[model samples]
Target: MNLSKFDFTRLKNLLPSSLKSLSINPTSDLIREDENNDTEFYSTPRFVHHIDDRARYVLSQFYTYAIQQTPETITLDLCSSWTSHLPENFIGKVFGLGMNELELKENPSLNQGYTVQDLNQNPSLPKFSSNTFDSVICSVSIDYLIHPLKIFNEVGRILKPNGLFITSFSNRCFPTKVIRKWLYMNELQRVEWVANYFLQTDTYFNPMTIKAYSFFDGNFLPITDEHYVDPMYIVSANKK
Candidate 1:
């Protein structure tokens, strides 16, 4: 959908009046089109990139730029899969959490190890210790999270002081799995929605939103693209 033509006023009118005065806190907003067991839905190990090559390159470059200050970084890849999408120069020890063990094991970027857990079913990270990781990254998978606030809290618990929690998403997703709220939002609103998640967490600070691709036009980036390029947005914050 062209963001410029989206009916934001209609969407706002459709929302509960309380939501207008509050953050993204409605439980109904998290409902998915497909409520079937997520484990079963993701049981098949499909090793594929959700975003295109150019978008992937942009994500890798963003990762490199984001994690450059932290040395010997211990990172967590949330909602991870067959690839963590870390830059080639990244030497960080990475742990992955996902629904498919086969895919997680196949991720070369997960140098430390991998765990198979459905975050939608269990938002807790009981296996990880507090302040254990220097960074946590979720790529193109945040839209599918049903219990995002809980997961964000877990990310804060697992991250060290000043640790980075970075999430990036493109104009692509498993439509049936994505939350209903995400479907109603345009690109700019989606960024605000993510930024609000960080704000509500309270444990995170200095939240930053970026248009990782040149095609995006949001509060963070006002550029437009006529070419057929995948648009990507990034929302990142530091653990307080």
Candidate 2:
């Protein structure tokens, strides 16, 4: 089934409620650009920001709102890099897990130490106790997961009761590293796919999606000049 060929616009209009039903069967949908190891792919530390400054600001604002400005909140950043996109006022503990040690170590936001691990090879977060974190965040890096269900389950297990699991992404990604299914879907479907991650696990509730850039644009100064604003989407849910 080449989902890329389907008119998702019509499907969305006809079966809007069924968008969350997009499930990834154990198949080639998980395949990436090559048989090469993901560790090797991410071995080099790329310190560049994937999204624009505006997008980063939007994400940071959303984080502030989601975490409710709680100074005692604890967060786990999965597939983290040099920056967690957390607000400067976010006075909380941040734990980071990423493939590159240099990248993780350089992240000042990670005050609770960091772990270097290739999640594609091992999705389990065994070192983390169950219900340990107030929130688990994956920023701009969810599409590369080959075993997302396992990872999502681990996130659910690590989150405290009523804790939030938030995944944010933009129009940017390493095309070669992103999963095949992700390449086929449009932005709206991708949002639904992330929601489905929570739905399939049956461990999360009150799922919500936020178009950060759009929200900011509508509420703040309207852009009249031609400039590139990276489209950002955040799909989040609360642990049941």
Candidate 3:
């Protein structure tokens, strides 16, 4: 999060005044505003992977190239799901925090380590201590945040200096679960939107670095001789 160019009082002026509605409607709040219903997101266990194998392979490359520096580094997998894709050779304490405890439990690698908390209800991610984790990765979940700038600022607060914050996404998402803000843009614009979330928050990040991996480039391997299509793009940044 870097706030050098974002004046607190002038924040509203930075965004475009016109907003187009390309979505059906905004998704229901992940957090119940009235009575603290934070436990609902964890009520059920869903053993589902969000993206295709091709996209995941791209993410694996990211773990290798972008996170080459992290070994035994305390890590936080934000909006964590069934897996954080930690390399087998990496020995470290990986903390996972997600909405479903069941999903966390299913992640044998996570080893029953996640807490069930709805961030949209409480942007306060109370599971980790400040300056604790060396790296944080949020995979494809930024579109669900009703409030992102605030969340990025908090991400900066909990991360150590020079810590890396990796956020990756594709063109896929549960349209009903994704916030209205995300549906209104094309894929490339979504990358810029994510970058600004860090820029408008605090001063804990270096200039946002963006990367896109191609899933379809005329290379194909068939499983069961069935045709499959993979479309995905990942954008990442570092927390300074």
Quote model 3's TM-score.
0.74
Instruction: Find the 10 residues in a row with the least total lDDT in model 2.
Output: 6-15
Worst 10 residues of 1 by lDDT: 12-21
In candidate 2, stretches whose alpha carbon ends up further than 4 angstroms from where it belongs are: 1-20, 69-71, 204-226
Give the C-alpha miss distance for residue 164 in model 1, angstroms.
0.4
TM-score list, all predictions: 0.82, 0.84, 0.74
Badly placed stretches (over 4 Å) of model 3 are 1-42, 68-71, 208-228
* Model 1 lDDT per residue over 1-240, tens place: 354354422322212212222356556899989999999999999998888776787777667767743457799999999988898768768889999998988888888888899898899999998999998999999999998889999999989988888888887888999999999998867876776677678755434321122334333332353345677777777887
Q: Give the RMSD in angstroms, all C-alphas superposed, for model 1.
A: 7.9
Model 2: per-residue Cα lDDT over 10-107, one tens digit each: 32121234334565865778898875998888889999999888788777877876774456778999999999999876888899999998888889
Flag the better candidate by lDDT, 1 or 3: 1
Q: Please tell me which predicted candidate would have the highest TM-score against the true structure.
A: 2
lDDT of 3 by residue, 1-240 (tens): 121232222322222333222222224433223333435634677677777766676665556555634345677788886777655555566778888776787765564277767887788866667888777888878887776766887888898877778877877776756766666777667766776666555377665332333334443555335565455555455666
lDDT of 3 at 203: 76
